[model samples]
Target: MSGPTGILLLDKPQGPTSHDLVGRTRRTLATRKVGHAGTLDPMATGLMILGVGSSTRLLTYLVGLDKEYTATIRLGQSTTTDDAEGEVVTEHDASGVTDAAIAAEVATLTGEIAQVPSTFSAIKVDGRRAYDRARAGEVVELKPRTVTVSAFEVIASRSSGTLLDLDVRVAVSSGTYVRALARDLGAALGVAGHLTALRRTRIGPFDISDAADPEGDLATALIPPAEIAGGLFPTATMDAEAALALAQGKRIPVAVTDAPTVAAIGPDGRLIGLISVRDGVSRVLTNFPNSEEPA
Candidate 1:
């Protein structure tokens, strides 16, 4: 039998990079086909979706899911990296800032807005990562991007001498940056703030509650790809013949609803593949068994 193949929801611990987790999982599972859904900074700890074996093909759909995070923004200082990982660029006394003012400013950033990502970010600038150029002391000018910040609100606040820290929860679209939100919030408040802490609590329907410990045995902890796929999209159960046909890369014409993608399940109870409707024809977007079957 082949090794377990599916998605692994890992509650990634701080300190280890996301790639580090992928490497560990590859070693533990003894497969080099592991891939992660989204990138999480080393300082962030939370749920991460890992695709194993044929399930790696499903990551493109998962990457664009809305995300949730709990973060702390220190309102007295700004950093080069927009987070605690970088050198402090400036400092100011935020003790005079009022709670009412903070709330008003956060409200300004709550809706759809254009935001420039941090220079210390993964976004590419002329084919080079913005972070790499920034770290090399080269100027990196990133254009503003339209991102939806559905919610950006202060949960709590604390003051320590000249500095103020606000505990916040944010719900944002796929490409939104919480660090940039902190930076912009501070800029709006005239106190120059930066992210002091960040933790991802959820990504789409998956939460930390669904994740396995980072140090646990990943192979044994795998969630069947079929199960994960079923939760992500509308499911279409096919009979043995139709399933086999789909698995063999045949387009099985079927009635379509409004779902952009459908999970096609085989009679054997495994995911045959994913399909989409184009011009009223149900076409295979991906064929799972083709990747799973021995080469």
Candidate 2:
């Protein structure tokens, strides 16, 4: 049945990469129009929003939203990848690490700070992935970037030999890396560290409960296009004249009440186009479905 299209929230499993999940969803839905909002590491299991059909247009708004994750950081050994999948390069006594120390480090990590992503990250360097360079024994020195760690709380801690396992929950802005947080936190305390577990709990307004099972029907899990458009801003119904003009990508003199982004709906409540307030005039950022049929 043809209808309004949008994104599906899936609770991605641990074994498959984000791209693998997209491939599986495409095969299941029998459509090549599927794409993901963001990439999740293979070791991470949690909410992944998959865009389908014309709904892929929504990613520009969705991907920039903040995300929340729960993770376990192991302080004692440094890893090549800064995660459990990497080989341990060094180990030391972590018994000296106290919960209070970890708390202080968390405080330091919170708020706006500079972060260096793991070398085994998807960040591109010289037209090659950082991880590829790292695996090839190449030293990848990446510049630190600004990322806001809104919250960084240590929930639990345990000590085993030289290992100090810390469970933490963090809410951060887009591009913030928990793996990097673990690495930096350990170094801040003069101990090497690596991430052992990670699970994303939320992405903006979307949460784990809103996600479907990894093997569930992703096509059916998609939120109705109207709901997707509705989440951005107050809706504005377009007349036949405005609709036709928008379908042609032509600018109109109509005023948008929203401050930043505004969704324009047609007479039937069908999402036609996305318009933004530029200075004072409403300019088109993008149009979903067909510019002719809906936009």
Q: Which residue pairs clash within candidate 2?
A: none
Instruction: Encode model 1's per-residue lDDT on 48-146: one tens digit a residue.
Output: 999988888889889999999999999999999999999998999999999999999999999999999999999998899999999999999999999
RMSD of each: 2.0, 2.5
Backbone clash total, candidate 2: 0
Query: Which pairs of residues have clashing backbones in candidate 1?
Result: none
The best candidate by lDDT is 1
What's the number of clashes in each of the models? 0, 0
lDDT of 2: 0.84
